[model samples]
Target: MTYFVKYLPVTTGNSTRLYTDGRDYCADLYEDLRSAKKFVFLTGLHFMAEFGLIRTGKPSDAVATLAQVLRQTGERGVQVFLLVNQFWRDESEVITGGHPIRAKIMKAGELYGYLPETLKLFDSLKGLKNVHCRTDIHPNSDIFATHHQKTVVIDDRVAFLGGIDLTYLDGDRWDTSEHTARHRHVDRTQKFWHDVHLRLQGPAVEFVRDNFLQRWNHGSLHTIRKKSLNSYEAWSQHIGEDPRHVAVEATQDRRPPALPPFAQKSVLSYTYPADGEEPAAPTVQIVRSMPRKDNWHRQKPTWNTNRSDEWEHSCKEAYLIGIRSANKYIYLENQWVADEDIWAELAAAARRNKNNPDFRIILMVPYEGLFAAGLGSNQELFIGTEMEDVIKASRSPATFGMYALHQHDRRSNVQGQIYIHSKVLIIDDAWSLIGSANAGGISLEGVRSGRDEPDTELSAIIHDKAFASAFRSKVWSEHLGVPVGPTYDVHDADRFRGLANKPGGKLRFFPGYDNIKRGVPTWFPESLQESRDPLRIDFAKQSRIIPSLSRDLLASGLPPTLVRAAFTARVVPSVPPGWRCWYRWHCQLHYDPTEPSGRDPRRAPVYLKLRSLKYDRDEVWNYSDQDSVYIGKLSAERINAETTTAVLGVIRCRVKILPLDEGPNDPGPSMVLQFECMFLNDRFARGNHPDFVRR
Candidate 1:
């Protein structure tokens, strides 16, 4: 009943190079883009038109910018494609007066300049005939969902994917490896940024390329124009273009680019001790958090869809699996660690390591995030408290260390704290996972009704000793100011503890981190936090509701034991063919304790109701119309955990459908499925330590 599914297989014969900061990433990406011959693909939350692809003494020079490279590349008929995240909220939140969320939006805009930059970037590529541009909007954008993947595939032979976006909003994303803050500046004050990226080649590149094509072929150039951005309507409407059509039409006949022959290449951007053993090309597996529903039919296989394509959350699965599999030490460096499930797993790991004195769990994150006044800082404090509570509740003996990164001058004057934008996890110097997906609910949790959906994400897990060891050593050396020798053990937990305690480098104890016992702050309400940093949907409540339903069936002259079996015996209706459907839909099913069932004195019957729905790609529907379908109520039964057979009474299931019309090159009808059954793999219901769910 667990929702965890191993979606992607481990791919071998892949060469990888890791980048710690923006300067190296920019330099390497620039060189690769210049070498691109067949096609160039890029996707991200924000792709600024003025973002410099290469660092120069004069940042104002247009020659080093991405727009310039894309222009030149398109002119050479290289077929450049870009998919950037653009949302309706970005416009309404900024321009709409008296909007409910305008204050928060304005605060964000004040910190990071709010510009119609997605449009700006698209317009910059206007004159280039071969350069194609599109905007990827989340289906639930009205509820604040947005695309968050930062990835690039060049010529279908090489790929770069990670947390760093090609934008200069908060600061120049192209900072040096040193992360100096003394003189670096773009528009406002300089910010020290610490992030990680991966350059991959071999069979693994195919996954990244396919991901780009899937999104590009299905996404649009812009949302159908509504109010503002009159310039947007003028530009897109005048052309009357379908970007998906344009991209697919362009690449339909092109032969798949053959994977280049394997070569022994260095995967490190820095010189580090490798125990005198050449690291083999890593065996890499690509994982992602993709949306469940789209406007058109998809070709990729999803976890739940039998022959159909739908949502996939392999990225979250990979994180939980990697943490559970850690044997010696766990190293996590992410921009945000706000998800309770992730923190719960860390707590469980600590308890598992309680008997081993050498066991350590280390976390490195930003001292202060982009919006400190919002959920970011509050979540940091809440996480520290959660971890502290677990340590007490479980009485774990594992050495736990939480630290942040900052820059300082010779006189030890605080220059700036480095924004830890890296999403990295190294386990026992043998396994590593890196990508753009943060350790936050928005990036890891699956979709839910009346709640935010997970961000679309792309990441890779590498199972290579050499690669993981080199990465840990290189990063730990910079933070601890200690040079690693050829024989130094990266996995020795004691060595790290000693070095971290005597840190003279960037590593500092996280601000406001304490061992005091406290719940989430009264000031930072969980409801507000859920709106911003939401948690995973709880589907295990079916266990409680089903039993109540069974009691009601008993009062209606149905035998107690047979009541549970009857539900499963009645076959559930299958999703109809000719409809490309989402495996699950959003429905509101609440049990009101005050309103008891008339059949049973102690039980309450669950009622199903509809919420706001979208029937077409652009229109919102408040009530069901001709375009919608309401399948009759069905019974979903509980199963024995091990036997996988029905063992409990029926849980009433509701299926609500929002049907969408086919596109120009239609494969079939697109349907939104909202059904209630049971998700057995709910971790919270699996009897995890009570402190995990405790305040």
Candidate 2:
């Protein structure tokens, strides 16, 4: 049985603007923030204080930064409300050690930075009489779960929502497909990032505004300072500050030039798309995974409660409905996907049309984890393998294919893989859902036991084909580096293949190495609407764990799966050799009618998991032998009259073989290699011919 429930739809007229990544999204959001004349309301997982939207390094310094603009707007008597999620996690545990109880106390004192890097931007705003900031933790919410809604509703007329978090992962996030790593400084914590965001207007945005106030009016602020920042006692009194009652009151001293309390907010009003930009005709609905328990109760509730709200899980329901109703195909981009119900639902959709043989599910996720689930991130690999196996074994009519996106400079060959961090879904190019919630258990589940409850999340549901079609084209254009105009039909399969087969594509697609025999249109990714993948993708040459310690495979009594103990010697001083990874990448693919799987010389990931060799014990580092290594047609030979494939073992790795043996106590010179594989979409098509498949 699948998770399905009818959700009462909150429908309204709306206008929307789609953004590819933080580059344009943040810039546009900055414009909206600076332009708002009345009030600014924002909620997010992380409102990073470290100047995210302001490009201080670039030439543009004309406009004020977001902080300065926010301050200036608030100073003009405009009400500003910021609700940030401040859940607990010993975030600084790596850097700062502490005693348990005392550490908790000290962490509370340093409240602004204690959360998961979410709410520092508004810390300085507490002083402003007009700008109100509060960090929220639901009385029933698991301490490990925080509010993960990324939204902004300005003047009650415009809204911004989606997967783009306001943080500086680095300048790499700001570049186009033709990326240059000139600003690449990996050590400084600025790694290139990629994400998607959206802008909204009309009645639909009204719900976005109301969501902020509902939480704001019910929300309680916890301030650390002793003195009140405002001259009048209204601000403190409103926050339930009883000066005479409790001597240990949580009071805050007023900020610079301390003005009297600002006027209160009443009836909210604003014009749609303020500048009179034409509003899109999309019918939109505001969907959310908001808790039913509003800030209604007066007293601060205890840590965790089980008071379920009216809105059980509207966001999750929305996803199930979309997947179940998808007729032609389902295109998705997400950060994490650990939902078994949704996977089953998609498989069911495939099974429904098995006789006719045509249902498509194109999913794009990070080739590796975005930091949460690494290549070796526990059960993800296991579950992923299971999902793939289920789709193949069932022989369902649905064609499920997944691919990772990458971009490389032609000259320097500095390949930058575009991380699919957007939590997005477009069903049959008719409906779209975008927001902060992941497809994983943490963000999708309504409730969970222990410390693994779902984070507070928000998403917008757009049912307009016009809006969804435009959004899909925008994504495809950015990826393929070719202009797919607004009128490109979403239902056209041959057109997508024709465009895909044509020469130039800025972005490169890498189907999972195991998908070689699936014989689907691997070249044309999910964004491009294509027909069912012909080949069912069946292959089995799997071996990801092989790093036997030379000293003794089991001499130290460590299990066979581990490649541990590089340096552990109390008396004799004997250091074990590090892991050496070896795996094959099947390239120059051709139809081998003679082979049982219809494919020979398969490519599989060479996985190596090593722990505490020189690093910390708690963390496991993942490395692939074929990472950044480019494998092409080294030379293909015909095996039979009807089949040909790349000669096995011809694509040898140039990277130094592991097992650094430079004496007993020395970690030898570090070896580095970059790899890239030419992913084949069709085995028998003219595109896979030697003349078309280039270096």
Q: Which candidate leads in TM-score? A: 1
> Per-residue CA lDDT of candidate 2, range 95-156, in tens?
13222212222232233233423334555565688887666665443223457788898887
Alpha carbon deviation, residue 575, candidate 2 (Å):
30
Off by over 4 Å in 1: 1-5, 58-61, 89-93, 100-106, 109-115, 186-190, 220-281, 294-310, 373-377, 393-398, 409-414, 446-452, 485-505, 515-695
Q: Give lDDT tens digits, candidate 1, residues 244-353.
A: 11101111212332323323323232122232232355567788877666443462523123233356667877788778877577889987776666877888877787
Whole-structure CA lDDT of model 2:
0.47
> Candidate 1's error at 400, in angstroms?
0.8
Model 2 lowest lDDT segment of ten: 565-574
Which residue pairs collide in model 1, if any? 1-680, 1-681, 2-681, 564-649, 585-673, 585-674
Q: State TM-scores per candidate.
A: 0.63, 0.60
Which residue runs does candidate 2 get wrong by more than 4 Å? 1-6, 50-63, 89-94, 97-120, 123-127, 138-143, 169-190, 219-221, 224-281, 291-311, 355-358, 372-379, 393-398, 409-415, 450-452, 485-695
